[model samples]
Target: MNTLLLHCRPGFEGEVCAELSELAANLGVAGYAKGKAGGAHAEFVCSETGGAERLMQGARFNQLIFPRQWARGDYLALPETDRISVLLQALADYPQCGSLWLEVFDTNEGKELSNFCKKFEAPLRKALEKAGRLVEDPSKPRLLLTFKSGREVFLGIAETSNSALWPMGIPRLKFPREAPSRSTLKLEEAWHTFIPREQWDTRLSEDMTGVDLGAAPGGWTYQLVRRGMLVTAIDNGPMAQSLMDTGLVTHLMVDGFTWKPKQPVDWMVCDIVEKPARTAAMVEEWISGGHCREAVVNLKLPMKQRYAEVRKLLQRLDEAFKAERLRVSIACKQLYHDREEVTCHLRRL
Candidate 1:
């Protein structure tokens, strides 16, 4: 309980730490360690007895940190042969061979690391087979590349190798504590675990009416129309013909912030380029007025004050809903496709 390992989508390390800091303020963290796993993954360390629970409650946690995942560390400075022996031994000891993820990390100064990896593939694969674990590729084991400056080499391992470790399985929440979706731009087979079709169905309405606030290219709108929902796309730009061809989205050449549905829609989605507060207010208006039962929006954060902006936005949204005597379940996250903003989904509680 003294230490807990946290993981996040790469490039979001600073935001994750900022989020952890806020959560820790309430639950308290003794200290932390941060690093990267190639370009796609990052890790943080905190105490389980410290602010782990609060971190779990943060907007980043639902989207970044997997709650039930366990990570253990093994640091060794052994020779090439010993390193191979140790890893093979660890794999043999592991109850589930498929769950073993052997990543070799060394500092930039370690010129022999690549050669070490080249030399150990045979032994590792043989040991894996002897342990009743199948190595998908005996010759080319996927080794994550990274650089760290320290005496000891640390090999981090995950016990639960579920879809959560897949490239596309991570949920980048739209808003903090709201519904999550895989990146439409980077959409691929790898994302099947990121958001199962079942979860997507729950968030959709078979007969729901809604609007896509920034539906230009129609990524979000495509999802809505496929669910048999009619959408009024409120954008100043042209939408994709395929989206328009769905014959479900009505293109509106009007400002998203100023436009209103003829009547209350069942849902409202926004991916507008606007301030976080402005976007939050729009959502607040729709949710508070019962104009929409559910919403998915993205807030563009300032280069600085990213965490502060996130905190402030959350506070404002909560207060606005409370004032209207309304309850909402919200999720906010830094999506894989997202750069400087977070995606959010708000549903009436």
Candidate 2:
């Protein structure tokens, strides 16, 4: 029970490990992380007893950049015979869970275990109910059973209110055929990830205005138009004719990095392929200078030290905002639709 399991994007295991290890150290929870390069999961094993519990209590899952989902628990070696009894016995020592989610890594082998997990759920839930270890109380903690294989599993627990609403921190979003490009999904996902659904009407209304930098091909701009927003689409390259036909966009041929909106807009979005630092700085300028009340930007990460760079860039934003006495809320995430990049959202509080 001294291990903290984390799920992340495959191939980013090192970044997740580095970030979690640093975070654990900051919280005075000494631990070492272990994971393969493309394992899609990492484990931080605390040397001190109850260190995992301390880390879980000290850190909020939303503040972590790399890990999609996390839990504190120990491994369960499933026996070939009477596996359900073993699972029941292990869970007997833990508190009752409000919900249960059986999961696996994002790898192919993990996917192969899905059917086994699905089949195991019914009997397991029946046994848990019979044993008084499962309940329907939403306020209680959730039992997360992450299976590496049919024979091995990580039985963990996380508070439902603190963990991601989705199983693996992934939102199920559908791509719209009416959109100009597939890139539209990235912005859509960013909004869902950063903004609360209940606030969508007030924050993203049809009467609002927006500016889209590097709006060529009109992926991100399409999202604004879909919201019935009047958008200034800045780019030198040609845009999608279908989007142009909407008559809600004003195309400006200019550099996204250098161009500034003449009037303060409700929203600003940038998806230009540029240095992460530069993008972060520009986003700060937009919010601090009152160019826009809110912004969503993308940062293209480098091949190495991606997590470190993201941390540095975010820290820079924090310093700048603090110095300028700006009250803003910032959130960033590597969305399901994003690749080698992260989406950032900044809103003035």
* lDDT per residue (tens digit) for residues 211-284 in model 1: 88877767667667767998898888877786676678899989888777768887788888888889998988
Going through the candidates in the order shown, the clash numbers are 15, 0
RMSD of 1: 7.5
The Cα error of candidate 2 at residue 200, in Å, is 0.8
Pick by TM-score: which candidate is best? Answer: 2
Each model's RMSD to truth, in Å?
7.5, 1.5
TM-score of 2: 0.96
Q: Model 2, residue 62: what's the lDDT?
A: 75
